[model samples]
Structure formats: structure tokens, C-alpha cells
Target chain A: MSTADIAGKARAPWMALDKLGVLIALIAVAGTVLPFAVFRANRIVLGEGLQIPFALEALPALVLGVLIALGIAIALMALSPLVKLVGGFVLLGALMILIGLAATGLIPPGDSFARVSPGAGFWVLVFAFALMVTDALARLRLGPWQRITILALVGAALGSLLWAGTFDDLSILKEYANRAPAFWAEARTHLVLAFGSVAIAIVAGVPLGIVLYRIRPLRAAVLNVLNIVQTIPSIALFGLLIAPLAWVAANVPGASAIGISGIGLAPAMVALFAYSLLPIVSNTLVGLVNVPETANDAARGMGMTDRQRLMGVELPLAFPVVLTGIRIVLVQNIGLATIAALIGGGGFGVFVFQGIGQTAMDLVLLGAVPTVALAFAAAVVLDALVEMASTRERAR
Target chain B: MRAGLLIRLVVFALLVAFLVNPEAFAFVFAPLASNGQPVIYNQGSLLDLTLNHLMIVLIATTLATLVAVGLAILVTRPFGAEFLPLSRSLANVGQTFPPVAVLALAVPMLGFGTAPTLVALFLYGLLPIFENTLTGLTGLRGPVTEAARGMGMTGLQRLTRVELPLALPVILAGVRLSTVISLATATIGSTVAARTLGEVIIAGLLSGNTAFVLQGGLIVGVLAVLIYDGLSAIERTLSRRIGQRARA
Candidate 1:
């Protein structure tokens, strides 16, 4: 045999034991041994863990048998790319359905007080399978557009599952049911606080950045001020804003009339806006500075005004970096908005703090999940925009 | 340079003065308080709270640096290269997930206390360290590494003697960022019953005492700035030693 062929044969088994294989093994072991769900006697009480077999007791024996078989197949065999991808989806789907079934099955008839929450095992299994699917997708080396399409598909699937009430039995959903109205209201406030701040930052910061770039001397002083502002903690900034804003609202003419105040949306918005300026202004400066000299010279030769050159040439070329700043601000503002609730600003953090106060983890999840999802969504959308902008510039 | 040194000394003196007797600053905050309200946060000693907060941040940042730098080293190596995507995703994942949300989520699993706060801070801090270390290790000039290889240096020796030293400044920058972020995050940990500076802020917010709010906010803000300044100085020194330009 050829040396290469001999080496390939010798390395076959070890090659099969790749990262995905190790992950799948972890999934199987964790899924089987750890608690799949917790059976809480009621809200506000600690729950008892139910292992996989007990958690899935309500499911048909055949379903459990299939789950075990699937786990073994994915773990023992070197899965084909297509099989791994499909297997991950199937496993996740099966787990979701089975968990719901288990919750429903575990609840005694007419006992509405009891709750069934997904335990550590359930999360671990979900995380592992999700990682496996992600790994499979990476192996396939799909384009950005393809990856985003898959993200949309996965999002839609999850949405449909939620819409279909697949997890209605889950305590998180139960908490959601209790304050559906408040949830939507808080969600709106969260978005407004996050996006409004970013919108303002972009409008003001870009122009300021351009001025800074033009003036040269003002750049360092202005940026140093912003840097100091950025170094301050979000909560502290929010807290500091209260006294001055309260004073302004009380003493300044027409301040209170325009919704300016120590607490609520005004202070939160201002604090977030202040926090946002550094990234936007600095990135805008960086982007404009990096715009090709050739483009600027061409514009000048074409008799374009300074404004025209900046608007038509520099900004467009620099659009991706500017968008990146907005993305950072948006994601950051979303997270910070949760803390805004502490000062009566009204956002998802209202739920978070309330959940903490009440010792209701599901309520905390209600706040946290959406905050994360919003940040993730903002990041993905902005990332896509940045990519499209950069590619367009490259093409030009 | 003299002015900068003077400013640093003043900041250090102020931090020491505040810790030694926070009530001494009560006059500064008194005007912001409503009638008859105490102007200083008195539930916990400001020094104790500040120390505890710093302790939490130190622990979390150290742990995050170790794990994240190790992961970066692993994924950059030939044998562990397949895990690069996973590590990249992890670093990306850290930024998208807010520290507050992570902290809240951790409460459900680990329950209320320092443990959950540590987990949250550690998770949140990982990205900067990992990303910077990866960049530092990989961004070395080809000739530099080639010369090391040509000198009959083993992989471990080359890594220790050449790669890590060159990468130290960048890696330190990452640790600085992580430490500052963990400082902010650890403040939020107070909501989860962790003894942090946020306790004073929360107390102020809860009681609607502007002075108390100012005290907490002032201390945390000053602490963050001092720590940031201290780290920047170290980063600059390291960068200068390595003949690389220091990044602010």
C-alpha cells in the first residue's frame, strides 16, 4: 500500500472522533443523567429534578426508544454533514415536544398551582444540540446570506412553536401569561429607549465627528471627554443623571412639559445617549479618515463641494464602520435599558428587578430573554448591513 | 506629564479619603438630598462595599483571562484548530448577551449570591481577553516567527520565549478591558444580593435619596476611572517596552 493510504487507514478511527463527536457524546450523557425538568410544587417554591426517563414518562415508550437510538447513532457513528444537520434539528424538536408532554403529563388533573420548568439538563441538551447544528453549518461553509436565511428559519420555527403553545406548560410561559399586557408595554419601552438613543447618537455624532476631523485640535479634547464618559458604569451614569435631570425638570422652564425628568424615559434616554456618543463619534472619525484619498481627489477634480464630497463619497465608503458603531450602541442600550427600570424608566428590567424582588426566576427570564433576543437581533441585522456596505464598497 | 502625575495622585488621595470616611463627602452630596434625608449611604461601610466589589471583579477577571487566553492558545494551535469557530462564536456570543441579562439568567441556575455574579462577570469578560489574545498571537510578522523556528526552538519554547512576550501588550489591553467591564458588571450583581457598590445605589434608588445615589454613583465611577487609568499606564509601559505604539 502507498504510505499515504496506510496513514489514512491508521488515522480513520481517531479522525472520526472529532469535536462534533465529543459534543454529541456530552449531549447523550448529560441528557440521560441530568434532570430534564424540575417539578415545582408551586410558584415561589424550590423544585425537584426529574431525570430523563422520569421526565419523559408520559411519552410513548417508542418515543423514548427513538430518542435513545438517535443519541447512540449520533455519538457512535461518524455522521455525514447532512445527517448531523438533520439529526440536530430532529433532536431539538423531539426534546421540545417531549418536554411539553412531560410537563403536561406530570401535572395532576385540576392542579393548576404546580409548575414544570426545564432544568439544567434540558438547557445543556439544547445548548449541545444547537452547537452541533452550528458546527455542521460551519463545516458546510455557507455564505453570510445563507447563514442569515438559516437564522430566520430557526427564528420562525421557534416563533411557530411558541405560537402553537408547545411550551405553555413551561413556567416561563406561565409567567408570560400572567402579565402579557405589561410584557408588551415593557418591550415597547425597551425598544424605544434603545433605538431612540442610537438614532439620536447617529444624527448628532456623525456631524460632530466630521467637525472634529476637520478642526483637528478639537478632536482629542472632545474624544477624551467622551472616553471619560464611556468609562463610567451604566448604572452609575443612570444614577447620576437623576439629580441633574430632576433639578432641570423642576427648575428649567418647560422642561417637565417636554417629558424631561429625574426618573422614567427622559433620564434613561439621556444617559444611554451620552454613553453612545463615544463609539459613534470615534468610529465616524475613524471611518472618514480611512476613506480613500483617491476618491476625495477625484471628487475635488470633479468640482464637488466639500459637502458633496463628504456626503456622496466619504460617508458612503465609511458607512460600514458607522453602522458598526450603531450596532454597538443599540446592543449596549438594549442591555442598559433593563437597568433603566430600576429608576421607574419602564422597560424589561422592570420585570427583571420585580422577578428578583419576588424571587420568581421565570419572570426574570421573561425580561432577560427578550433583552438578549433584541440585542441579538440588532447585532445580526446591523452585521448584515455592515457586510452589504463593505461588499458594495469593495465592488466599487 | 507633571500635571498627569498630579491628577493621578489627587485621584488616589480622593479614593483613599472616601474609603477612610465616606461621610466626609456628605457635604458635597447634601444639597442633592431632600429635606431630613441622610446624605451618605450608611447601610454598609463604603470601604467594605468597595473592597467586596473589587474582590468580585478581580476574581472574575482573573478567571476569565486564564480560560479565554487558554482557549485562544488552544484554538490557534494546529491540533486544536477545528475549535476556532467555536471560540469565535463564543467571543461573539459574549458581546451580544448583555451582562445584566447574563447575571439574571445565572440567578435561576446558581441562585442569588456571589457565585452567579462571578459566573456572569466571567462569561461577560471572556470575549475581550480571547479576541485580543487571538489577535496578538496571530498578528505577529511572518519573519519574526520564521526566525524563531529557524533557531531550532521547539514549539513550547518558541511560544514562551517569543510569541507570548510579543503578545503581552495586546493581551494586557484585553485584560484591562475585561477588568473594567467586570467592574461595571459586578456593580449590577448587587441586585442579586451580592455585596457590591450597587447596594448603595440600589438603597438610594429605593429610598429616593439623591445624596445616597450620588455617593454610590460617585464611588463606582471614580473606581472605574482609577482602575482604567492604572491599567492604561501598565499597557503603555508594556507597549513602549515592546516598541509598539500604545492604544488608548
Candidate 2:
């Protein structure tokens, strides 16, 4: 075979795997598992009682801590091809986190983040694997500058954690500042949930956005409902969920126990998902409209079916603009999602609400700092993804 | 164009139907729990309080326009391009920083009064106003600016007689967006005990009186958004007039 042909064949699997979400899954699982397995002690104290092989009840938190650290690690190492220096920095950073956990006896648990405790090692491996595979595919789409930006964001996130702190029930800024690591451990859950929900939002919304755009009546109808949905104040809507859902869960036998809510993550995620739809949907519609009538006509002239025209032409052409909308939605939600803590949806917001209740500013930062960083990172990543994925911008 | 108009008309009709029968509207508009509350019309009505809210929006938008346009002119002066984005970013950061948070911080220093609300409104209104002003002015091609200077115009003369006049259309558009956002945001003023129509909505949300809360929220929300639309129409008309005058 020609060398060009050989290279194409070799790269195809990796490229195909990346598209299938294998890369992010690998990152998430490996990054989550190995770190947790190696650093269980960093999660909790060897509390006063001893019955099992592990003296501390911190293993659940250790898994979560490892997953967040891995998100940082992958976000950092994803830059290795561009910077060469970041890969080493990520390892060193991970090591330092492990050491710091060893120094602090606080395992930081017994809260909502530990809700789905399926054994830290097991969950870590699975999540990291999934996250890694997904990211690998996305990595192919990102360019050098985009990779550099992600690395820089990952660095800033680490720095923010240092700056932000884990006041956990301390209520005082000074105390929270001292216990920054634990505070970050708490903040990690919120960031993960938001990221996870936004991920699902993209999976569902992006294609649906494409579908609705092509069908004029559907677009008009869906967009109108979304507009009205946007008008409802977030807390009020979330509070509204309490009465009906609580009633439904009480009566609806096998249904309530399933979904993400169980009265906790369910409503918080639903509320965030609803709030998220307006921007994503509108932006998609606006961006798709801007896709130039000429292109849509050309796609049709080529004898392409409606589906081909949407996927092969309009959606790709309109992606960057659609991303801008997603960025707005994601950024706004990161801040507003803090309200989720009020309903037992874990994240950095736990501190914001708790602090507000007690009138403690330090506690609020425990939630606020990471939230701001997460929003910033999300904004940057959306830009990178849009830039990398679109061939139209490449011609520039 | 015809389609958009038809769609807006249908939406308006639906809005009327909902307003006339809030109980039915509640199923579609308010969350399920927010039905069956009774309204006390005298204390709860927003129609009577329209002037107060409208003035707040108008005055705040005007102040925002003046500051934003002034800043836009200074930035566009021979040395503008480099500094313009920085100013734009600050305005964005201002808008993005949640008006509620800004109001909270401003309250402690400005005290329990309208002054704090004004400052918060001004800050909140800066983004759209500044962006539109900058977008409208600097985007003027070199020939346009040069022609004004050729007329023996001083820098200030160039700005008022040429740049500002030509840029008015776009700046007003920006003002419309800013004014609407500010009107909605100003409702947070109620938290600090500042007098505005928002007091009803906030009171309703905090108390769980479904009917009272719905009426108060519905009234304030409708008025704020409608006024937003009203100001937009005025902006379009004003922009058209300015453009026509400049052409003349």
C-alpha cells in the first residue's frame, strides 16, 4: 500500500474510536480509578471505630476526589501534543494532591456527593474509562491553540481550587481557607453533575436542534414553549417541583426510585436541563437560520435527502454559532445551578446556600469559586470544540 | 416576514386568554403547585404602578446611554481600537455578574434606598448600551469620519455632528435590550426593601400564596417584558428619525 494509504488506515481507528466516545471514557475511567486505588487514604480519616479492612469511611469520597482530579489531569494532559510540558505538570499536580490528602485528616464526606456509593474503586474505573474515550474523540477535533487553551483552563481550575476552599460546616472564611482541599472535594460533585447534565443536554439537544430547525412548524412551536420556560424564575420552578414530585413519588410505586431525582439530583438536573433549553434551542435556530439559504439549496440540488442535508450540510455549517448559544446556556446555568444545593443536589453550591442560611460569606465561596471556574472552563471548551469541529471556519 | 407577524399575533392572543383566566394559565405558566391563591387587587395591581416602573426603566436607560455613548466616543478617538474591547469586556462582566449579586453588594454601601437601586440599575444596564454604542461608532468607515473632519470639525464637533448622529440608530437598539434587561433585574431591588413593583412578586414567592404570588409575578413579568417591547418600538422609530435627519 502507499504510505499515505497506510497512514490513513492507521489513524482511522483512533479517529473512529474518538467519535464513538472511547477517548473520554478512557480518560474518565482511568483517571478516576487508578487515582482512587492509589490514594484512598486521602479521602477520609481513620474514624474512631474499626470493623472492616479500611479504618476510614472516606473511600466513597476518595473515588469522587480522584474523578475530579482526573478531570483536571485529562484537561491538562490533553495538551501534551501541543505544549509537551503539561503532561508532566498534570502528574506532578496529581501527586501533590495525594500528598496533601495524606497531610489533612479530613476525608470530607457524609454528604450528598456520596449518594451513589458503588465502591470508589469500581466507580472510578468505569467513569474514568468512559470519560477518557469520549475525550479522545474530541481531542481529534481540537487544534493546537485549542489544546493550549484547555490546558491553561485546567491549570486555572487547579489554582481556583486552591483559592476557593472547603469551609464544609466551618462557616468562617479563615477556617474554610485552611481546609481548602476538603472544600474542593465538596465542590467537585456540583461541577461533575453540571458537566454530566450539560453532556446529556448536548446529546439530546444538538441533534434535536438539527431536527427542529429543518421542520419549520416544529421549530416555531418548540421555540415558543422554550421561550416561556425561560421566563420562570429558577428557584420558584424548582420549588414547584417539590409538591407534585413528592406526591407522584409517594404514589407511583416503582417509578420514583429510578431516575436521577429520588427527590435529589432528579429535580436539580431537570430544573437545570429546562433552564438550559432556551439558549441552546434559540441559538441553534438562529445559527441554523444564518447557515445561508444558498447552502441548503445546494444540498438539495445534489439530490441529498432532508436528513443528509441537515447532518452533512446545515448542522455542520451552523455549528460554531450554535456553540455560542450553548456557551451562554452553560455559563448561565453554572451560576444558577448553585440553587440545586438547596434541594440536596450536591455541588459547590452546598456552601453557598448553607452560608446564606447562616450569613457566612466563607461558606458561600466554598461553592462560588469552583462554580465560576467551572463556568469559565465550560465557556472556553465550547469555543474550542466549535472551532475544531467546523470545516467552514478552517477555510479561513 | 408575514409568518413572524402571524406568530407574534397568536402569541399575543394566547397571552390575553391566559391573563383573563389565570387559573387555566397557571397549569401552563406557573408550576403545578401555583394555583388556587386569591388576589387582593388594590395592593397587588401593577397597572396602577406602571408609571413608577416605567420611569425607573426610562431614566436608567437614558443614564446608561449617556455613559455608554460617552465612553464609546472617547475610545473611538484616534486611540480607540485597542481599548474598546477592554471596555466591552468590563461591560459584559458587569452584566454577567448577576444583577442580584451586584444589588446585594451595592446595598451595604448605598444603604436602604433608591440610590442603591439606581446604581445597580446603571451597572446592569451598561453592557448592551456600551456594546451597541461602540459597535455603532467604530464601525463607521474611514471615509465617513474623514468627511466630517474635512468639514473643519473639531474632535467634539466631529463626534456630535457626525459620528454620534450616524451611530444613533444602533445605539438605540442596544438601549432597547439593556432597558429590558434592567427592568427585569431591577425587581431584585425588592429584596433590599427598595420600592418598585417587584415587591409584590418577591412577597408572593416568599409566602407561597399561590394566587397572590401568581398575580403579582404575572403582572410584573408582563409589564416588564411588554415595556421592553414598547421601548424597542420607540427605539426603532427614534433611530429612523435620526437616520432620516442625517440623510437630509
Candidate 3:
């Protein structure tokens, strides 16, 4: 065959089906066929599942119609970016609304004992559509500003929906409402533990990194020690600290005054700080080491001291890499901070462990969803910062 | 040098002594326990706990490495290149997602036990292996593969004889990392009723016994460090045998 004929053959519809579309289609089929929500007599007991038809029994037929139409649209429109993006958003919005309505409709009126939760199929549908939208966004290749704007818009939309009590009927939301005050308090504590540990690590680790960079022999030894520390399981590290810290709190003067104890925030913070050190110090060292020697030479030619070179020349150039290390630490610490709840450090993990103890999955989601969101947001923001920092450096 | 060696020997001897007859060292841990509470973790033998812990980590890390490396290999092939972005994002998501959260989420679907913990550990361990294997397989120098192709080796033969051998050390580094991380992560499995070392620690936490916590922490920490060091040594030796510098 001629080249043109071959090219046309290769570009045929069936030959060029979008792979992501296939995945979405498969997930959609599974989602449509499986239960969308579960209806329970109470929060703790296993519940009966409500498939799409039963789930939509409470809502108008139009909701189910929209849901089906959106699924098909998303699957078919995968090759068209704008259509895919809009379809993904619309599908996600429809799913959320349907879930809330389904929960509201499923629950017996004035029956406080009933619980309605989004089921496996609901999650599958959400995941598929979210993936679809994310793929479309990636294809758009938006700049940093546009990406941030989208992130904010998504956040605001979710926040407003949450604030307006759109999902208050959902079991997870009911759990949240029950512990609204505690939830906020734990959210603050989670942020603090995650950010605070990294802050301390940065303050301490940067200098250590700089010192080690200057003194080559110390770098390997210090990093090795830190690496060993990093290898320790976070729980083990936290556990290991309890005895010494408890001893200090009991016997040492002014220790308890500052909240030093065996099982709580002290051990948690110390453990997180220890874990944070290796990433921060190593990345800082790498960044400083990678600073252009020509820049150093120029600084020297200007009669700049070692300290001056670090502050004015080397550190500025190295900031992005150091920030990268900080980013890794932050995302890591946010996750680790959940474990802090086990030690009484008071984070979202409180809900997690408590839920596990009570076999309350909704309560567990109350903790996990936020922790994941926080970590994901931290990763995104820091990633953008890292990008901006490097671009700025390049311009300079 | 002699003094340092002597100090090391003494420490080693003391460790052995503590292991052989731990009750003798009970006095040292006395301050950690409340009245009538045991000064050592007694829920299970320390050795068993350590072995069980290692078993969970081993299973999870091995499965993760197999799946991740397999997926990486598939994506690197021309026919599977379309999947590269999806696989990459999945790996990234796996990394960013925390093990504890995964464990908690899994509990709802899979219910409590070693099974959910295995799923969590498997997901948690995928990213490093996937990324490293991708890097190893794709980052191969062009001429080496070109030569293999020119020698008339089939695609399967070239991959097995040339590509995999060259990439083994790098892939091993990923395995080492995943294994070490899994070592720590399996401890959390105890929270989900998994028969792991974290049971001791959690029990200690619940009972307000610092001794149990200390004992559990010490064992897990030691196991992690030992495994990490052992794997590092193996990775180094493998890299040396292949005439390539170890990345670390």
C-alpha cells in the first residue's frame, strides 16, 4: 500500500481508540452495575447495598438519566479535550448530587439510627471521572498560575458544597457533624504537626547541611547516621522516644512545664523531626554542592567571604533543591502526623484510630480524606513553588 | 583503635547477655513499668514478632516489586507506550498516598486483618520500585542495545540478555528501598489486628507501659537497620560486579 493509504489505515477510528477512554468505560460499566450506596440500620452494622435504580428511587428519573448520559459522554468524548473536561466535571457534579440525594432518600424519615454511605461503585465512578478530568488538565498543559487557579477553584467548590451542608445526609458527613469542633481542632493539630516538624527540620537541617557540604568527611558520616534514623519505623521511633522523654519529664527540671512526656506530642514531634532531618539535610547538601563553581569564583573575585557567598550566591541558587527537600518532608510529615494521634499528639489520626477501634468506617474517612487532601495540596503547592524558584533562577 | 574495638565487643556482649537472660536486665527497665506490670513485652516472643513482621514486609515488597517492575517494563515497550502516563501517575499517587491512610481505607472494604495490611503495604511500596525500574530500563546507553540488536538477537533475547542484566542493580536498589520502608510500615499492621510487632507497641501504649513500647521499638528498629544495611551491602556488591558505581 502507498504511504497515504497506510497512514489513513492507521488513523482509522477503531485503530486509534483512546486508551484512557477504555479504562473510563470499564469503570463506568462496573459502577453502573454495582451498588451506588449502602443503607444501614445503624452506623456500626453492615448495610444492604442500593444499586443505581434503587439509589435513584428517592430522586427524579432525570438524575439517573443524566448520570447515564454523562458516563457515555465522558467515554466517547475522551478524544476531544474540551468535551472530555466538561463531561468529567459534569459527571463528577452529578455523582455528588446523586449521592447526597440518594442518602437523603434512603434514610427513613426522623430515624436517627439509619445511615446511608456512598458505596464501592460510587467511589469507582468518582475515581474514574477524577482521572478523566486530571488527564484532560494535564493535556491542557496549563502554566503554574492557571494550575493554582484551578486548584483553588476546585477547593472552593468542594468547600462551599461542604459548608452549605450539601452532603450532610451522607454518613461520613454525619460523623463530621457530630464531631465538628473536634474535627477542626484535629485538622489544626494535623497541620501544625506536619508543618511544625518540617519547620524545625529546615531551621536545623539547613545549617547542618551547609556545614557538612563545607566539611566533606562529616557529610557521609552524618548522612549515614540520619539514614539509620530514617530507617526506623515511625511508630518505633515514636515509641523509642517515650522512655527517655518520660524520664526527663519526671525527673528533669522544667521538662513537664514545656509538655515533655512519654506518649504525646513531645515524642511525636521529636520522631517526626528526626525523620524530617535526612531529607532536608541531604537535599540541602545536594543543592549546595550543585551550585555552579563559576558563581563561587565570581563571588570570590568580588572579595566575598564564605558566608557572603552562601547567602548571596550559593543559597539563592540552591533554594529550589532545598525547597524540594522541604516539599518531600512536608508531604511525608503530614502523613506521619496521623500516626501522632496514636501517641496522643492530637491530629486527624485520632479519628482514624478511634474509628478503627469502634469499627466506624465513616469516622475513618473523616480522618483520612482530609489528611490525603492536605498532603496532596502540600505536594502541589510546593511543586509549583519549586517550579517558580527554578524558573526564577534560570532567568537570573 | 583497640579501645574502640573493646567498646564494641563489650556492647555486643551486653546485647547477647540481655537476650539470653532478659529478666536480669529487668531492673534497668523497671522505671518504665508501673507496679505489677511486666518490664518486657510478653504478648508474644520477640523473635516471633520480628519474624512475623519480616514476613509481612517480605510478601508486600516482593509483590510490589514484581508488579511495579512488570508494569514499568510493559510501559517502556512501544505497544504499551500509551500507558506510560497512566502508569506514571498511578505510581506517583501511590507514593504520595500514606500507608496508614491506605490501611485505614482498606479496612472498610477488606475488613480487618493481615489481608488489608498486605494491600496497603503493596500499594505503599509500588512507587519507588516502579520509578527506579523505569529509570533503569529506559536510561540504558543506546550503543549497548544497538550492538545487541545488530547481533541478531530477538527482542526477547535482547531484553533478557542485555537489558535486564544491565538494569538489575538499579532495580535492586529500588527493592532495597521498598523493603526497608515496608519494614517500618508493617508495624502499623498490628493496628488492624495483623499479627505484627506493632501489637506489642500498641499494647504498651494502651496499658501505659513504656517497657513494652521500648521492647517493641527496639526490636523493630534493629530489624529495620540490619535489613537496610544488608540490602545496601548487596546493592553495592551487585553494582560493583556490573562495573557501575552505585547511585547512593
> Candidate 2 versus the native: TM-score?
0.60
Q: CAPRI verdict on model 3?
A: medium
**Better candidate number, 2 or 3, judged by TM-score:** 3
- The residue-by-residue lDDT of candidate 3 on B68-120, one tens digit each, is 88988888988788667766666665567777889988988788989999998
- Per-model TM against the reference: 0.96, 0.60, 0.94
TM-score of chain B of each: 0.97, 0.75, 0.90
Model 1 residue runs over 4 Å out of place are A1-6, A9-15, A58-65, A68-72, A75-82
Give the alpha-carbon lDDT of every model: 0.85, 0.58, 0.85
Model 2 reproduces a share of the real contacts of: 0.00
Tens-place lDDT per residue, model 2, A230-337, is 655554455545555665666887657685332467777777788777777777777787888888888899999988987898777777877877777777777666
As for candidate 3, its clashing pairs are none
Q: Model 3 segments beyond 4 Å from truth?
A: A1-15, A58-62, A65-73, A76-78, B1-28
lDDT of 1 by residue, B55-150 (tens): 999999989999988988888888788777766765776698878888988887798889999999999898999999999999999999999999
Give the per-residue lDDT digits (tens) of candidate 1, residues A246-307: 99999999999999989889989999999899999999999999998998999999999999
